[model samples]
Every structure is written in C-alpha cells, then in structure tokens.
Target: MDINYLLIHHDELLTYLREHDYAETYVNRYKTTIKQITDNASNHNWTTYEDVYQWYVDQSYSPTYLHEVRAIIGKLEQFHLHGNFPDNKKSYSSFWKIKSAYTKLSSEYKQLYEDFETQTCKGLKSSTVASYRTKISSFLYELQCKGATSLSDVTEKDVLTCFFADGVRKRSGSLCANIIRFFKILSESGNEEATRILAYIPNLRIARKNIDYLTDGEAAKIRQVLEDSNYSLSCKDRAVGRLLLHTGLRGIDIACMQLEFIDWNNDRIRIVQQKTSQPLEIPLLPVVGNAIYDYCINERPMSASPYLFLDSRAPHNNLTTDGIGYSVKKIMSAANIRQEKGRRKGTHIFRHHLAIKLLSNGVPQPVITRTMGHTAPESLSSYLHADMKHLRECALSVEDFPMAKEVFQSCLK
Candidate 1:
C-alpha cells in the first residue's frame, strides 16, 4: 500500500481497468483511492480484504468513503489472488433453475422432463426454451397439486382442469398449444397416459388478428424525424430507425449487426436473421447507408467489438433486441405516431409497414415471401386484409352474376 509501490505498478492497474472497459470516472476514482491508501497505510504490504479494511478504518475514513475504498481493496486483493480481476458483473436469472415439480415427479417423468428440456435447448432459442420450461413446469405443478404424483396418475379431467383454471379459457389457445407439445413429448417418451390425454384434448383454433402497419403518412413522418438535424435523437437512433424502416430488418438482426456484414462495394448488407437463422441480403439504400455511416463515423464508440451497433456507454457491449425496440418506440413517439390499442408498437411495426408497402406496390406474393423470409407462401395472406385497394381491383361486377338476381327473386317469392 506504499505510494511508491503503487506509482511503480500504476501501468498494470490501469491496463487491468481499461481491459474491463471501466468508465473513466471509475478508473480515476480507483486511482485516487489507491494513491491515498499508498500514502497513508502504516504497512505498504496489505494482501487481504481484512488488512485493507482495518487500515482504512484506522485512518477514520467516513462510512461512504470507507465502503468505496474497501471495494477497491477487494478488487486489488482479487487480482493478487487470482492474477485477474474477478468478474463482479457475472450474474444470471434464477428462473432457469430446475422446477420444484421435478423433485416430486416419478423417476421416469423426471427423466422425461430433462430430455425434453435438452431437446428444446438444441432446437429453440434460449428465451423460447425458458418459456416452454415455465409452461411445462406450471402444468406439472398443477397436476401435482391435484394429487397426481406421477404422469400415469394424471387423468384427462385433471389435464382439462389445469388448462382451463383461472380464466385460462380466454388465453387457452397458446396454453393448449403448449400442452399439446408437452403431451407429444411425453408420448414420444412412450407414456401411454400422455397419448390418452392428448386424444381427449380438443384443438383450440385461434384466429389471426390483423397486424398494424404504418400508413404512408406515418412512415413519412418517421423518415422526416430521422432526417431532422435539430431533432434530439442520437446518431445511433437515426441509424437504427432508418435500417428498420428501409430494410425491415428484425430487431435482433439490427442489434447483432457486425461491421463485416456490410458489403460497401456492392451496396448491400448481409445478415443471418436471428429468429429464423436465414441468411438475408438487403440492398443498402443510399439514405439508410448514409445514416449508418454517419453513426459509425461520428457517434459509435472506439472499441474492438465486432458488432456494428453497441451501447454508447462504457463497457461498449452490443445492443440488445429490447434496446433497439426502445429506440424505435422513442422515435415513433417523437414523430407523433400514436399506437393503436392492442397493436404491437415496437420495431416489428416497421417490418409490417415494409410488407404492406411491398404489397401495395403490386409485388408478387412469392417475392414478398422471399423478402420477408417467410417459409410458407400462405404466410402473406394476412396482409391481404390490409390491401383494400388491391381487393377492390379483384371485386367482381354484380352484372357478371346474373343468376344471383333470379335466386334473390325466388327466395323473396
């Protein structure tokens, strides 16, 4: 803790701090605290948290400053012990812990759940896997509460009750689908009870609701907002907004974009769509291209991270999907674009807007399908509901159905 020793070792400490992307203010504070400790500590060789804390207390430092100094001492001690700073930021959610129902399950059911989880992890995104696990856990917990300790003991009535409990009938479609998948997994594991329960559960047919898309005026307003020099929006915001509006890239795609993905020479951007894992090549329109260029050149932080978009703050981590969605919503609000009730108001609205634009321009369904990365041709059918102009074109004349008049007269008589 000698001042001379810290001065000599300043380069090493600075390097460690910088490597962790510690903010400038934090780094300066640490340096100041280390200098004070070096100058004042009776012994210049404290190697443990207790020794350091005692030294600070002996100095009669205030409680807050004592806490701060202790934190620095802890970091230094960790470095001496491990040869590297411990990642204090390392954390994860407890939601992913094994469900309580697992302990009550029969050995066979326990193994079945484990296998199902493993398979889901392999085929689905982490978020989707977590959702499936939650739903399955809830169902299992419900069954256990109903006095069914094993999968074999679960009756069709129990399954129905669990699916319909607590006003679940209104939201039963997705729950029904999840239950169906659970039963399928169990049936695959050779559980005859699961197959029997599956046979008795009727499919809940859910209607597809029309998605909200920006009208031409709203789209124009958004573009104008992005291009406005006096607007308070940051360069990153403008870049993300233009990319979503022009290319219809999903939020995850924009968040995960890399510098290497841009083919500047060809004026195209290539991305592996995160949701579908499909490779997409979108033309780099000049306006959108300029916005990205302005952001990268002007506002993007200087970091070695490969991602094109990053959090502007220190640590400079890649942007998340939620972050991008929030940016889009902010821009929408600034542009005075009101979100309708029950309509999704996120970056995805831009995608829907792009699809509607393509459809309005008379782009063929096959082309739209490819552009939107839809696996099925029929997936574009919902957009038809919004294309009233095209529907009018397809309207048949009443004169063309002369037999309809005679049928009406006969019915009246």
Candidate 2:
C-alpha cells in the first residue's frame, strides 16, 4: 500500500500505457505529474491514501487540477492492485450513496422512505427510477431540514414550506405531485397521517413550450462542417454529428448504440428506444452510413466492447450520453453556431430540427412518429410549433378588416 513503492514501477506503467495507445501528450503529462509527486515524497514522508489526500489539499491548485491528480493516484492504485491498469469503472458503492439527511432520519421516517423507494420502483425503467429516487431524496432532505422527524410530525405547513423551498417559479410541480401520490399510497395502506398530508399538496399544471431547433442558416453551417473534409473535426465526432443530423436519434440511444444495429446489406439502422423501451428501425442514408464506416474502420479505438463508438482514452468504453451531447456542442462551436449568450446548443436541437424539417416537407405524422421512435403520435405535435411553413399556410387575409389604404397615406409620406 506504500505510495513510494508504486512510484518505483512508474517507468513500467508508462511503457504499458504507451503500448495501449495512450496519446504521447497525455503520457508526457502523466510523466510530469508523477515526477512532482515523487519529488515531494522524497522531501517528506507519505505512504497512504490519507497522506496523498493531504498533499493534494496543501497544493495551491484549482479544483480541476486536484481532480486530475486524484485520477492519477487512482491509476497508481489500480496498477499496484491488478499489476496493470484496468478499464475505467466507478466503485460499486458509488451507485448506492444516500443523502446525509436520509442517514440522520428517525427509524420510522427512514423506513417510510425506503418503502416509498421499493414500492415506486416496481416495473419502472432504470432511468425513470433514478429520476424518481433523486426527486424523492430532495423532497426528504427538505422535509428533514424543516424539522419533520416522522410522518406523524409532518404538518400541512411543513409540506408547503418544503415544496416552495426550491424557490417560487422554480418549484417542481411534478415533484409535489409525486409526493401526493406517495401519501395516497400510504393512506391506502392504513396510515392516517399520510391521508391528512394529501389534502395539503395541490395538483400542478405543466404548460407546453416551443421546441428549440436550428434555423436554416445555422443548419447550413453545421452541414458544411459535416460535409467538408477540410474541417478539423475528428472521424468519431463527424460520425456522431452526422447521426444526430440525419437520423434524429436521441443522444442516449446513440451513446448506447451497438455495432450490430447497423444492417449494412439492408441499408437500415435499428435499436430499442431507451426512453420508451420500444423498437425503432430507420433507413441508413448514404451520408450517415459513410461517416460511421469511416470511424469504425479507421478511427475507432481497439476495444472488446460491442458498442459502435468508444472513448479515445485507454480502456476505451462506450461513449456516455453526456459525451455524445458534448460532441454536438463542440461541433456547434466549430461551426460558429449558437455563439450568442444563453443560446441553446445541445444535441436535442438537432432532433427538433429534424422534426420540423419533416413536418415542413409534408411528411406524414405517423412516419415522423415512427422515425423518432416516439411511443405516441401526439409527441410529434410539439414540433409543429417550429414548422414555419405549415404555420404560414394557416394565416388569414387581413383585407376584410382593413379600413382603407389612403387613411395611412399621410403616415407613409
């Protein structure tokens, strides 16, 4: 467990990383960081994780730099334990972390929350379950802060205070509605206090908003970046961008895409939709097909993962949802699109753009619904707001209500 012992194998580690295809620049960085740690250890004595943690804290460096240092130390630990670097993976316990408030709750309240978790998660998808767990934790944390130690101690006033604690306009109506449903479930289970709390929570009405999509000019610029070979985008980045632009696949779905999903002979791409758990199949256009082929054959990292895309780093794994979104953001920056302050630049914009384009082209609603893998046809209605061509056709003539053109002649003059 001695940190100094690990430092002795540093040369071997660098050689191993190099053999595994780590970038030369990154290898040089690792060399410098390890040298600093080694030199500091020689001046003083440090051998354990605690010593390394204190050393990290004493250094006057930004949080980002400290995090990088921590990653290096983690790599060293992996080398020492496994005799080689393993794939990037989070610890098992990281997935089960509970909020400090949950730990401090009374046994009864803790049981209540645990029961809510178990009951609510049944037959739910992983993503939906994760979301519900987070909102429930936030709700419980606020309730505990407001001094409600148990269900019996919870008052209507405490409910309102905790609900509004997230701030007025920002208060999550879905969260409150979820809490109401939780209490209604408990009431059916013969808990009178849960029944009383139900009357305090009100139904929240959510309003629909216009979807954000790329304008014609912005779309043209993105297309130029994807189409032009002279652009500085990597093969992987180009592949991801083209998939979003041409297929309208959700970022998560694209991140989870497998190599076998592409039916090259049939010219189609197929996968189960992540959000809705439904199967979707779409034609593989030449542009998207070519880009993917370029990345897979020439640029993709050597990995045993069945995923179509892998990270550029060693122990390359499937790209994550955030990673896919970041690729889109980077492409946008390169294209000089959405550079204005507070402009939306996420991958979902490409989805909206695709929907609007199809709608404008008079593509049937059922076709758009199937292409986007929407569970219901009604989901396609939102993009109609951005379908400017269709909106124009609905406009009526103002000639009937006009007083006279001559009445405005003086103002025109």
The best candidate in terms of lDDT: 2
TM-score of 2: 0.81
lDDT of 2 by residue, 1-413 (tens): 36556677888888887897788887887788777777777666765654665677797788988776666666665576666563555431221245445566667777876788787777668878777656666676677778887777788888777656566743567776777777777788888898988888767665665555789899899999988988888898899999999999999999999999999999999998888888899999999999999999999987788999898887788999878978888889889988788888888888999988999998999989988899888888778887889898998877767867787787789
lDDT of 1 by residue, 40-111 (tens): 565456644466667778878899987666667666655544545534432222222364555666566667
User: Any residue pairs clashing in model 1, and if so which?
Assistant: 1-44
Return model 1's CA RMSD, one decimal.
Answer: 8.8
User: Which model scores highest in TM-score?
Assistant: 2
Q: Each candidate's root-mean-square deviation in Å?
A: 8.8, 4.2
Model 1, which residues run further than 4 Å from truth?
Answer: 1-104, 115-122, 166-171, 185-190, 207-210, 339-344, 394-413
**Residue 113 in model 2: lDDT:** 69
